[model samples]
Target: MSVRWSFSWEDEEWLATRTPPADNNLKLAIETLIVPFGRSWQAVDNYLEVWRNMELEHGAEYSVSTPSAAVERISRDTVEIGDLYDQFEDVRLPVDEFVTLLTDLSAAMRNQ
Candidate 1:
């Protein structure tokens, strides 16, 4: 199945203020997107890794994971912050807020 990102109106407004990112910067932007949106994956890399593994094993037989799945899994103890998996939909937030929130979460996770 195909996946698409979601952006709230506030997220769109916040994104509009920033300049377009280069192709290489897409990963960073995606990471920033998921932070405050309550996604469970630690970073975008985790999401990609999940997708990669799933592709290797199932060859698209199963649906991909998404931010909604992340949130649900986080709530249910199936996944934790900083873990990566496939099947995620894009969840958008302001870059500044996302960076700050993620930084705080990362520190907390490391300390725990």
Candidate 2:
């Protein structure tokens, strides 16, 4: 599954809504990470740098050898990673990758 990653740098208020007393973490993430690249490769690259540094606060962190699992993990962390519409809610234009995935999924479901 392809995942979309975005954090809007243009909107600072986005950070105030994450991780509990999330006054800083969430906003910083949105403003500096995804807003610039939107759903592009550069955007995901930025997130990967940060994600790799995270320790999850209460569990073990292990090396991820599988590309599929790594993508899933990143997608899960972005909340709306699997979403096709939200990338346009506050960010710039998105790539067609998400649109393609959703379309295929819809067709498959219809066929079922």
Q: Best by TM-score, which number?
A: 1
- Model 1 lDDT per residue over 1-112, tens place: 2222323234322121222332423433444435443423365445545545754675533333444333212221122223244433334333233333445444443443
How high is the lDDT of residue 86 in model 2?
36
Clashing pairs in 1: 42-82, 46-84, 64-87, 65-86, 65-87, 65-88, 66-87, 66-88, 66-89, 67-89
The reply for model 2, stretches above 4 Å from the true place, is: 1-16, 24-26, 45-112
> Per-residue lDDT of 5-95 in model 2, one digit per residue for the tens?
3222233321112222323433333333233333344434434444455425312332222121121232322222222233222222222
Q: Residue 50 in model 1: shift from native, Å?
A: 0.4
Model 1 clash count equals 10
Query: After superposing candidate 1, which stretches have Cα over 4 Å from the reference?
Result: 1-42, 69-112
lDDT of 1: 0.37
